[model samples]
Target: MSTKELINNIDSFVSTDVWSPLDPYKDEKIIFQKGDGAYIWDINGKRYVDFINGKGSILLGHNDSDINQLLIESISNKSSTVTGPHQYIVALSEIILRDLKRDHYKIAYFSTGTEAVKASVNMVRMASKKSIILSSGYHGWDPLWYHDNGPHELNKNDILDVFFVPDLLKRAITNNKGNIAAFVISPDYVYLSEKTYNELFSICREHEIYIICDDVKQGYRYRSGNSLEMVGERADLYVFAKGLSNGNRLSCVVGPEQVMEFSRDFTYTSYYELLPYISALGTLKKMRNQNGYMQIRNIGATFLNNLREILKNSPIDMNVNGNGNLFQFVFPNDEIEEKFYRLCLLNGLLFFNGDNQCPNLAITNEVYDFVLKVITQVIEQLSSNYNTGSFSINDERRFISAWRQMDGASDFIDTSDRLIIINKLFSE
Candidate 1:
């Protein structure tokens, strides 16, 4: 179906406050019909490699046979929720506690990452008896952290103290003093030096402020010896989602007894749901039995190292950042990024301009080799056309002919400011 007709029969074309629809190649939207392993087929049956992986949720890949089998069993057995506790939930909680090596921490269930984050903040507030929460990194869609995204201007929630920058965190802590509740953080995408990490932790500890480690996106991927691990010391509370059920809709907040007891008074979805619990249990088992987390970590490391090698001698002024499991390229200009995406899409590859490349277990050596080949071709083509004065970004044939003199003029454009910004944001 046409994009217009598809949206016309469903929802309006207007973008929501929190999310704008992704712009496919040539501004045309695509609706995917099916997926298997690391590939997805569009409605027209055209296949493309899927590196997005459902925003990093499907670590095991699309339509994973093992997970699907479990799901089917649950459905056929008529296993469902009844608004009461389930024995499987207790088992799932135990699995999380054991895997995280947090024997003293309690787990509270939620249906989504945002809900878990909100719950984590509330828990810190209740335990600390403080109103302000110092935060860094994106913490999901809710009035608490994300109001809007306008680069120079983002609408922050007015109800709470949620600071975006590290400097602002220090200032807020000073302004609030003892009124600071927690210092929430996500370390997956954001690059903070060891000095910054230590400084932030020390400041929080000095003021007796609670620490909430938002691990929704990085939990399972950073596991060591069957336990989830991060770069720094453990926090008082940890919010987990996304990688837990490998795309299943389940999230959680885990913390110590004193802080988690507040969950009794907090209204949340009951943990009696059977399907998500089954998914969680099965996913955790797969990870543990196959040592899937470690495997994934190794896979990511391999990809990153290989990517660095591939781009090392290239003329493209780009740098990769983020942890081994999640990384992105820092480009010099949005137009360059847009062109890169278009090129990859036309060549049976998918590339999003969001600056994150999340790999899944489906990224085998063969799959990665194909990806590298495509990337090499894209980069080579770009480099060849850089100073040739033969390429035109515009699609209008008449305009392109008229503006032939402008070709390669873009090469003279200075992008020093953009490079400076990238370095400032990611080099720390």
Candidate 2:
């Protein structure tokens, strides 16, 4: 189909908001209607290597035998819920709890990541006996008490009293002191290890502050059992979602029984009837049976490191930054970024723009190697033509001025300053 037609079709569904016709995606809409393994097919039936990985949920690849079989079995068995018990539910939760070996942690099956997140914060507040929270996280939107994400632009529910840095905790403590309830951070996929995880955990521990680690996007990327096991003794509550079920809607909350289980004061209830429970259960089983994490994670790491080698001399400052098996790319600037994107499109390679979210995965050895070759080729092509960098200081000022003109941002972000930050982070 023509670009105009694609744009029209998308506009029909999303006239406004993020997916609206005014967005950048309006021009790039591929309208992929089908996917299998690492390839997704657009409306015009063009197949591309899906690096976006259904925004990181397609790690098992489009339709794997195991996930597909379990999904079909779920339909075949019909759905069930509880205040009662089911064997598969018991078994799945057991696997999660068992592998992690945290006797105090309890697992719940949620319909979405944000749902799990909302539930977690509510629990933390209930146990902390405090009103405010200090967070260094990109948790999902829920109205609690937000101090970041720039105020009301994302809605009050999504905002919770969150602090983006540990220093903020210091500043807040002087003013608010014991009033602060919790400190939340994503130990994985969190920007700059120098700043976030280890230090935040230590501070939270020292202060006796509640630590909530949001691992929604990074969990199960490499390890199945409590993905932030590396957080190392500071988190009072832990949350994970992204890799829990590939594309299946499954998220989990597990932490110290001392804090999480005490949230009985607040109501945390889901209908508890979801087919994805079985999907998640079966996923754990399959991973167990195949030793999936061990095999696939090693494969993924090797693949990523090889790409880094290929791009070693490229003028564009690209960094392959991630842990275990998760994948993401950072680019120098907008012009180079646009060029990288076009090259991927022409060769049918896929990757996200900003965070690159989670790069999709190949479940099998053969599929992984084939696509890795294509990606290697694409990187080589991009490297040869690499013209370096996005968002000039002037452009940053324009965006700021435009937003300010249209009322204003609740959060204070110096765009000119951020330009420097982004550049420094991407530089090897």
Compare the candidates by lDDT and give the number of the best one: 1
Over the stretch 303-414, how does candidate 1's per-residue lDDT look in tens digits? 7788888777777755555545676665555566677777888787875454466677777778877877898898888777675234333323222221121111011112
Give stretches of model 1 more than 4 Å off: 1-4, 7-21, 24-26, 146-167, 224-229, 267-271, 388-428
Which 10-residue window of candidate 1 scores lowest in summed lDDT? 402-411
Q: How far is candidate 1 from the true structure (C-alpha RMSD, Å)?
A: 8.1
Window of ten residues with lowest summed lDDT in model 2 = 402-411
**TM-score for candidate 2, residues paired by index:** 0.78
Q: For candidate 2, what is the lDDT?
A: 0.59
Query: How much is 287 displaced in model 1, in angstroms?
Result: 1.6
lDDT values for all models: 0.67, 0.59
